[model samples]
Target: MEQTTKNLVLASIGNIYEQSKSSSLNAGFFESADADLKLVSEYFGVTPNQALIVAMVFALNYKGDTVDIKDLTEFFECNPLKMLEYSDDFETLFNLGIFKKIKSTHRMKLSLANDQFIINQKITEAILLNRAMPVVEKERINDIIELIEELYKLGKQVDDKEMESFELFRHVSSMLDTNAHFPLVKKINEFEFTTTDTYLLLYLIWRTVNGNEATEVGRIAQGIFSSSSARINFVQDIINGDNRLISENLMEVVEAEFFDDTEVKLTANALTLIHEHGIKLFGKKKKSKDLIEPESITVKNLIFNEFEQKQLDFLYSTLSDENFIATQERLEKKGLPKGITVLLHGLPGTGKTETVFQLAKTTGRSILKVDISRSKSMWFGESEKIIKRIFTNYTEYTKNCDRTPILLFNEADAIISKRRDAGTSNTSQTENAMQNIILEELENFKGIFIATTNLSKNLDTAFERRFLFKIEFNKPSLAIKSQIWHDKLPILLQEECDQLASRYDFSGGQIDNIVRKAEIHEIIHGIGVNFDNLLEFCNTELLAKKHESNLGFSKK
Candidate 1:
């Protein structure tokens, strides 16, 4: 067997046995330990002597104290394998001891009165074994040693504070590559790494390592800062890389390439780069960055018609109320309460979702948009767990910050619609279960909750009444549509833009598509505002929408 594999098996056995001894008084403890050991023995199929060696080592070293191998053999009454014959078996264990070794000395002597033989520490024995290995094996041994140490650290019992530290460690470890290549020392400006920035960076590091969504990054920052000034300061630091807040040790592991001899301080550009690339450096598989948050979005850029704007203004004003503020404060001071919900009903292509974003942005709050369609499941009770996880994540995030995060339920009517005629089949049961779960979640939710649905009539009246604000978003007027087109299109396309805007009966999304296509046309054809390209793009969009409408009709 590979030395590392052997050591791992031994360690597992040791841990199980130690756990057994610790809870020996308990009736099930020994039985549980015996079962675990039997499992380990079955897994490794090692000799009895090897099993005993492993068990003895684990028991003695559980507290990270030293143990002499010779003494270990005597204690367990197991014959010691010849150093040369069982070299591979002992290699991994020996190397771990070497890395953990603090001090060692060679001494062969008998106890003065007791006639006991003195020996070196377990760590010393491991080191001696490591040194005896070939040069190639020595490197492999070193790697195993480091791996063991890391696993040991990860398994250590941690308090809340220590947990935070461990999280920081993981974050730093993950960002080592990014930090090394784009070392914060070179990238961050001298003035930026203040106390507030340090805390924010620490929080960012934690979030980064824990695989939290990027949209939650700002919310995490807001939670860490106790005061407005601190929050502002953190934002400033994020907008400017001020100092080396990440650890140097972590930077080394990733072999990060540093800018040579260049005292390049963090500029706005550096901050932008960190925001864009730092997430990638964490080594997670790239997921779609489609999750939308409120503060991160800009309404000025979106195509909001007059009626949509009016509804947005009302919602924004409601969110800005002192009552809302007091409610939020109360939630933070005590804990989250139940029965806070908002319903935004609108037709397709209206600004229900956009308004939700605007409300969150205006209030300087985070938004977690839960897609109800995606939450549906085939298995009984599985959908409930998925829905619960979403709420749990939102709650945990808010609790961490002591701020209420806006929970956005998109297409909520589909999930929480009024019940059909009484039916007890699995599908009906699932639907009923989902509705109950959502209602329960809504009742318990203390923070801002916004539900957007196209078919408002389909929603349960009980659910509808829970919303503090029930707003309807209607289709935009021609005047508002003209403004949306003008705002959405680029400034360089001037007179031609007005003419193009006037022609199309386009929604906000269609207008956005037109602008994107126009940009591409301008870039490829070298024509700044070609009428032909604009018309072509518009026709394509109109045709696509028509095709979708026809498909929906056909399906119906």
Candidate 2:
């Protein structure tokens, strides 16, 4: 937020806008705003015009056509068309159909297509801080309605126009009063905040509600900052310089810019700070999905070889506070990344995934399993955003979590694959970008991260070096396989288990699967656990693997 940095960003944004305006004027009609919008929209997914319009709506308190283009231009130091963009802006928003247009009954001298706009009903509910409401039973709903009615009657009379807004506010107030509010908000509101700080924070919360990580600092200033002429300067003062209201060290917020074209997510620490102050002009934080519970695998009962067991024992010891906390200080002193990143790579069905689960269970850490396929997208540039968002979410999660959870990227080969050859399509570019983000995040990570991949050969060289520990999970040894068989199907004699384990080159997972099939066969057919049936199931499993091209095929 330095003066030089602020001026540079403003200049860059203004240059893009000037080009957009020039193009519009040359054609003698309002044309594509892509050039300007692209610059700002690159950060947020919305078009530049759309971002500007949304900010304006919030600034003008959702006034329809009553919003003044001249005032907006003077306030943000932009052209009138950039402020309004006339009918093109409204039409585009309408086409997106997230907003409803209210026809202006009164004629205006400014231009054509006189209409006002407000967002959808659901959006209004969300904006009003009612979207995070917990579900109640039918009987409780009736009681709540009756209570609201009683409260309404007791309240002072208001005009019909203001009545609806007042009632909604009162209802939200009643709900917060009756129920236990969000713990974070309760704790956050204890700190005092300036009015401008409260508004900016509300805007940040609004963006998150709409699934955006953060809004562009420049656009945010144009939309929300006070002062008509030097609005951008005010934003700089609020964030940077001496007497700044929001700073990284003091508020744990940031206004980051990604030089070298690396993606950056800048959150103004708006939500956290806003939550501290109980200003309700903007909507409350939307309730996120409940954190998925980690699988409860009994680590004590898990089987492993001498080397594997030793590695796991060492892992558990290091993860424990007695060693880890002490060593972390030393690592920081040495200027090395303090995160413990482990790569568990090897053959399919080799217990790589299970090992991660057991490690979490043993260490009393929760596992956030990342499915690589889910993070990918067919759209251009979207995959990279998804990867960046994942890391950002993880950073936030670690900040608030009591014990940092292990981020397990399962079947990670899909993402950590060898960087695509240069000059390929956007898909290849996105894949490389994804790897870049992962690599950078790994370098800076301060929590535990574990990645499992069957195809280690496909992994990028850069990623290999980032992992603190690289453990290969090869197929279980004969003795270990025999132990697995006896453990899973205890009915089998040791001799029989040894014969099966010795004859078949199967992983622990394959052995477990075969045992499960044998158990199901016995249950369905009342055929007591037969060796022939178990062997037959093992043969089918092997054949299925061959059919899937997982095993080597013979060319006759």
Candidate 3:
């Protein structure tokens, strides 16, 4: 141990002992004896004396009380340098709200704001656990220990002793990773959950850990292979049990409303259960109502012609970060709408729906699939209510989501079709009501909305005006057909593929169907997918379409 460092440590401790006894030192006398202090301060930056001064302030007073620096020096029985030399540390602590001061009244004075017990406990840890402290400072560890003991005694008198103890050991043991995994977590793990209840519990936890998207009741019903009504009954059964899995008693569900149509997230208890037992729930988490799950297809999976591909590239670029930021910063400054609304119109199986999925996957957004059939209601005004609910859910969803999701209205012929003149019939009124709600929602819409339809001719002009980009997906060109044929059947000769492409005028979807049939036949017959088998499959597909009867008269 260096003689000078030892003297500085002992001297600092002596000063604190005098302060505890409410005595004062000769300030001018210690000012002349500051040589060794400078050497120690140069090495340590802030000495134990300074830490003790701050600790004593915290220990002796309540938060927000005015404390004077001059008073602190007098109370500590030391020259002002003992407290002033490390004023920077105190200033930093003050800024961090460990201590605070009034700007107008006595600016040099400060008051403690942070808990004294916690600070002392951390200081105790620094002395006990840290191996890097100089050996010369080892004898002075008793001073820090005495301060911690005093703080602990004071803390236990006013607060929960067990909780304070828990905080101290929990810091040392690293027991709680998050507040979600703390004191009450063991209560959930103690339950003996039933097999069915356990599956539901783990499934919710797994979704939260891996997928941040919202999970709806319909999706949870589908996941458990039960009807929605039956799923509700199952949940009720669990909540009614002695060891309730989804009850307020366990805090697994904060509200009863969460188990219904609302999107659900895992409660803190569920998270704790997964960590404690290490259970893995294997199912896709339902995306938030606005967000559709990410599509499995990438842009590379999209097989469009040169013109269509370029159009898609433009759409993708429009969704890029640079353009979005520019729109928010520049165009939005001029009061223009900040969102993009696109309409994809073409024949079925022409990749309109798949394109939406691929576009969402490429641009990193979720898709919200709007089912027109599901939205329809037999009751007079119920259909309009459903449509409005869709928009309301979407608005609520965006508030919680990280990225804006694509709202997909696939095969939207019913909604986008021309509105019939209003008559006294209930059906006509319901249709008009739904269209009105949709129009209003679109006008006010601020997020990405995409609608695809086979019959764009029937689309109302008013609805068409709302779309910023309307892309017409036509049948594949001859060259594209050849590419599709070759790509689907790599074993086929180029000449045969060219001949097929020339003879057939098929959409990508029809070609995909034909190829699938041919591949199946080849597997069953133990033969290569030859030209003859391909033609047979193609004829069968065309025949199926021909035999189908018209379910409704062609729209006027």
Q: What TM-scores do the predictions have?
A: 0.48, 0.53, 0.48
Residue 22 of model 1 has an lDDT of: 34
Q: Per-prediction count of colliding residue pairs? A: 3, 2, 2
How big is the positional error of residue 253 in model 2, measured in Å on the Cα after superposition? 19
TM-score of 3: 0.48
Once fitted onto the true fold, the runs of candidate 3 whose alpha carbons sit more than 4 angstroms away are 1-291, 298-300, 525-527, 545-556
- lDDT string, candidate 1, 361-432, tens digits: 767676777777678776456677667667755654564443466778887777767875547577777777
Q: Pick the candidate with the highest TM-score.
A: 2
List the global CA lDDT of all models.
0.52, 0.59, 0.58
Write one digit per residue (lDDT tens) for candidate 3, span 1-556: 4545444544544454444544443454345434434443443345544445444554344344445565566665667665556566665554333344332232211222212222233333333343223322211213322322333333232232222222332222221122224323234335655434433444455445455434554454444532346556655554344335545332232223344544445544454344344433223335544446665545536578888888888888887666756765675788877668899998787889888887778677777788888788775566886787677556544544566777788888888788887886776677778889989888878888899999998989988888888988989888888888888788888888788888877888988898788768778998877788888777777785676665557666
Give me the runs in candidate 2 sitting further than 4 Å from their true place: 1-268, 275-295, 298-300, 525-528, 545-556
